[model samples]
Target: MNKLLIALLVFLFFSCAKESDSVAKKRITDEVFVPTLKIDSTDLLGLPKDTGGIHKGYLLNETEAVYAHMIYTPGGYQESGEGYPLLIFLHGWGPRQLTNEIGTDLNVVKEHGPPALIEQKQWNPSFPFIVASPQLEGQYWASADVHSFIDYIIEKYNINTNRIYLTGLSLGGGGCWYYVGEKGEESHAAAIIPISARGEASIVSNLTNTPIWAFHGAKDQTVEPINNYGSVTMVNEINRNSPAVIAKVTVFDNAGHDAWTRTYGNQFGETGISYSPFNLNIYDWLLQYKKE
Candidate 1:
């Protein structure tokens, strides 16, 4: 009788766990998402099987022919064949405009942000998202160009459209602001993390519906802290009427321009300095919202 009772408990435990997982998945499926960008299938490359690990490639652009990119797929990606969330990282000015040679310039991209973590093998292999870091040829990344690249990549992979996230540092952070402002109601990203950059106050209305979590350095002389604070404040003021989305900002008192390192490295969460009440890392914070 004891053996039969133990067997029944084990069955019930597994059944409850499976049901919880199914309900979580159903929540994601029930969320509605209308893709903002028109997927451009032209010049799409024949991608290799996603057996996992980082793959280097270049964007097929006529005007900007030398745009290089790196993609990292977590381990066991091919086994599930499920649509995975996508994280697109835009690098700042230092890594851009390198020669089109994939062998040399491509390595510059992996020196920072998510790519750096993956290259050093510090990133968790079980992390579920596919990270795409794109290098720019110009000083500033245009929203239109970024959107075109997004269209190109979606056609090239099995991305969960509703869970697409955008993140960047410095100029790339400014690029994130530009993207949402220019796209306005048509932005495709579900959330954006802009570090050490300023957003335009005039575009606060455009960001009312978008989820924003900006970061800045208190001593940042390059880009003043007010830029990030001002924009977030504007958005929150307007949200007082509807309060659907709450914009957040984390200012590192001792830090300067290089705020992206700690953020992308999850040091904030590890050191218990995260602005989030739950001490969630940026990845966890980003995953919480998905066009719902």
Candidate 2:
């Protein structure tokens, strides 16, 4: 009898110990091992379908000799998985090289503050808009490669197809006119903003339905305010044909060729620059239009 009782007690102790070990192993597996198997949604490298998006810079060849830098902004919609708006910015004159121009002339850090500073300001992380700042190849103008880059972003990002915005400065201003007047009417931009330059007057015939907001420095030296003759003259001509197009011009008296500082420097600390009335106004103006 004594032997049997001792055997029974030993069996019970071993069984309980085994059960405790099993429970501990199960708990550890549940807590640590399982999460490793599950995929993280924020992993940008992971190719899980629509798991996380990306923002990147691309170099594109528009023609045989023309290549440009494309700055892509991805959408942050958690549920919809829909396409987003696009903003294509054409840089003025600098080096013909795409990366050099981007690093120097179109340096977002110099002009619009650093990316980290921008994020610290709580600007929309997923602004859902792509901005391509294509440097003109050689002595080329925005007319040569601007539209092609725009088309590329439209195709590559699978953009919203409806909402597009075009902006530029100096020579790019002239390019803006070339776009809206010559090619952009039927293109996709909801509105066009050109600073310190104007396109040919003859091209205004097709711009009757497009909205134009032009900025010029009264003191501009590189492209004089007198060039307004081309811009205002074209808008007037367009109005004569169709009064529907919304076209207006704004001139800053004390400004110069760098009217872009006023044009894009709005939003308070948006660019780490002092607030300019011009910047605030332009930002408000741009938000009013979206592609139909």
Candidate 3:
């Protein structure tokens, strides 16, 4: 063929190819085949909600008694297989909040804490947790009750030896730290979250690698933030040399002493500093730690 004809033929072929590419791009712009990978619900690593079914119990001794409200796995307490984490919850001063007298009834504790989250607020935990909230017989937590309850539940449930978590509010917040103080490394709890509570910084020195996230309200008068949140700062100071024992405090400006109402994991909302109208999910943060 002539050179001019050959050149014309080549140009036509190139034009056709470009046109074809343009058409394909247009098709994709209109509707491309986007692929999605489906995940199985069972394969998902998560926890189920308690569905507001709280069982009541009493840890009693001759001179001591502790009322408890518990929520187990969705499969129930006995049905939960292996590797379930236990969430030990200590409710804030409930005698005055729940009832006037200690002998009144256990119904008061249910109005707040994990019991209130699941039953009243309809809060759902996004992790498979066997949560137990102890209603203090007095104004504060009794180390004896915490120690006994830990033993009791360990014996009763198929608990994850490493993933135990401790959390509480107000008086209960201090109690959580108090338990950590008593057990320290021996507690075997993976992480600790205290809302509106505190303990001596000297005692927290023992938590060399235990993770702590404390929350407090600036406006709280019931239990000042400095007490509990200050305790967290003290932990940070004490364990500054240890990478594993860093403590974080999320302080709110307008919130009151009821910081737990805002800062709990996977309840009321999906965790966060838990401002009045918002929730910053911290459940994942709590789940990040495991016993070494």
Candidate 4:
């Protein structure tokens, strides 16, 4: 009789475990695997494949005028139904003429091609996301038009609102500060990475609830390292007032206005600034934060 009782107990335990496993699987399927909106050709530029090559052109030309280009990498579309995160990149000044070669300029394209993160097939197929690169018009910053473009992309591609990210260099860096300070909540970006640009201290108060990671070159001459002081100081003050926000400021010694080169380029080896490594770092950092 004891042997029969023991066998019955083992069967009951396994039955309970199977039922619990089924419930957990159902929850994950219902919550995490919901179908996201499908992306069409009109939704994004560039060819179908992630490594087809970079697509360049004017995304939006309005009264103010905004010229931009983008690179799209759809994850294993057949494997995942959920939408992917989006990363918007704002470029610094380019040639005034807007020549064809301007799209491939060293400063603009440096570390952005060949082995770029966006071009990697492994990362593209597994972690599908859209990358937008906008080059501002003459004397115009990426503040106004880039923000609108971001909204357009989000609506068009059905982007996962929780995973949006922003990054820039030099003038673009300044624009990052401007955009995040002004319309960050509207964009709903997970985080902002501003390289070598100083944002307004007044705006820091507004971003006390936002996640921001700023990088600057200690020896920067063009924008100057002191420019970052105001933003950093404001961040500290705001954090003191409200300790809930997560803000980090990193200064690279012996670096200059080209801090993006180090921040974006591979840290293990010396290479010109590229988006591969920096993209990885920013995405990893961004995953930790989510909209409430």
Candidate 5:
């Protein structure tokens, strides 16, 4: 009888756990996400499997531990030529990994974001620059690695220090915000564009000296649009007391959680034309700013 009871209790526990997980997934889908689903499970996203510029790379931290990454260099870029602008992109959450094929890390090294744009031919190679996207193993960006990697790339690639920029979407966006706040001054970043993600509200004060162009979907559920607004509002308030800062929140109406579609794709409306300074279809604006 005791053996039967023990077996019954185990079954009940597993059943409850399964139901709980389903409910949690449903809540995320129903409340936070739309009905349909389209995300890379393999995380083999970003550049085409054949795309040449992007190569798998890794960075070593103070402990000499390796952090895997995806790196992209614009075409015709030469190490001996004038230095290229550097853009350090951070990626969002990938599908849970099934095996550790790529590395022992928890997340798959997706070729998404900047790498995807360049690989898919969405980003013009004429915009000469270097993009290094580090696949993080956690929910958010790490400042220590961010600082170390940027320094490493700048030194190794002869990147124009004045033209270094930062940008990311969702988890990456939040990471960008966090990094800019914590180490923007130290890193000497030219600007940052965070989409559908914002860090601590109070962190805005720390970025009065940084140019920020934040984007968010009005109907987003995963991360509220107000987060970006809060950062912009706070920056504006603080700007009034110091050197005026440039921070804008570009809102996408009737848009879902995937603000990145327009953010990185630079697609605004049917024409993909500039709707406002907020919604831009070009990358020159980012290049407009350079550290003095």
Candidate 6:
């Protein structure tokens, strides 16, 4: 009788532990959303279909769902032998409904960054990376959400793990800063380009090893140019070196909060310097770094 009782107690304990673990796993899997591997027209109305262009689809988990996000793949992505780099582009704040409600129009995402260029039929087909732009569901872009989506993208596509990049404008720019600052060395972005938003300078130490090229308008009152200037300056101060000082900020002296237009459009005005120190565009600058 004593032996039987002891055996029963052990069995119950083990069963409870197993059950707890199962519940925990299910909870985790359900909470975080993951995009479907097969991109489709589920929420793509005003957006272009995935005919070797921007593809729209839903990011869903077991429990919750958000509206469709846009992703752009290179022309020969399916046939490429080598893994292509991945660029995760985050957009700034849009219409109030875009974040507060479900089924918001997907076209708002293309208002800035690479997605806009794609919609305009101006994105170079030879561009060498896979781009994913996830819309903000709430007021801000959370780092955890960005991390999870990145994990999904890395797994879902033929991504070069060493060459992942991140960029954003306005509110999205702030998200970029928050993501890299919060994740530190684990952020996994080879480089980040933040435009028109000043992020927290308190997180400067976190950016020591990360290459950054921040842009802001000098005369802007919306988000002062000092925000980005101060952050980048602190980074350079923390890790002072010549060519080694990879973190830099470019303030458009005559421009306003809309510095992203020229930057993303790769259109530097007459005073805009586009060569020598760092040539071409932000895209080329991003491709210059790869994690060791």
Best by TM-score: 1
lDDT of 5 by residue, 1-292 (tens): 9999999999999999999999998865553332342212221122222334544545334223334566677655567646777888877776222333455542244445667776567666334667877766555677776787687677677577887888887888877777877874685578888887757656666777887777777678887766544333444554564634556667677666777777777665521122223334335567767776
TM per candidate = 0.73, 0.63, 0.68, 0.64, 0.69, 0.71
Q: How many clashing pairs per prediction, in order?
A: 0, 0, 8, 1, 3, 0
Tens digits of per-residue lDDT for model 1, 123-198: 7522367888888988798888888877766777777677788999988988887898789767788889988776
The candidate, 1 or 6, that scores higher on lDDT is: 1
State the lDDT of candidate 3 residue by residue for 89-142, as single tens digits.
777665333543434544566666666665564556556567766566566676
The residue-level lDDT of candidate 4 at 239 comes to: 66
Better of 2 and 5 by lDDT: 5
The global Cα lDDT (0 to 1) of model 6 is: 0.68
Error of 4 at 115 (Å): 9.8
Q: What is the C-alpha lDDT of each candidate?
A: 0.71, 0.56, 0.62, 0.57, 0.64, 0.68
**Candidate 1's error at 245, in angstroms?**
1.4
C-alpha root-mean-square deviation, candidate 3: 10.7
Q: Which scores greater on lDDT, model 1 or model 2?
A: 1
TM-score of 4: 0.64
Residue pairs with backbone atoms closer than 3 Å in model 4 (clashes): 111-274
Q: After superposition, how far is residue 5 of candidate 5 from its true place, in Å?
A: 99
lDDT of 6 by residue, 199-278 (tens): 66566677777788887766777777654444334435535633334677766667787878888887754322421122
Point out where model 2 deviates above 4 Å: 1-55, 60-66, 74-80, 98-128, 142-144, 228-237, 267-284, 290-292
Q: What RMSD, rounded to one decimal, does every model reach?
A: 12.1, 21.6, 10.7, 11.7, 20.1, 21.3
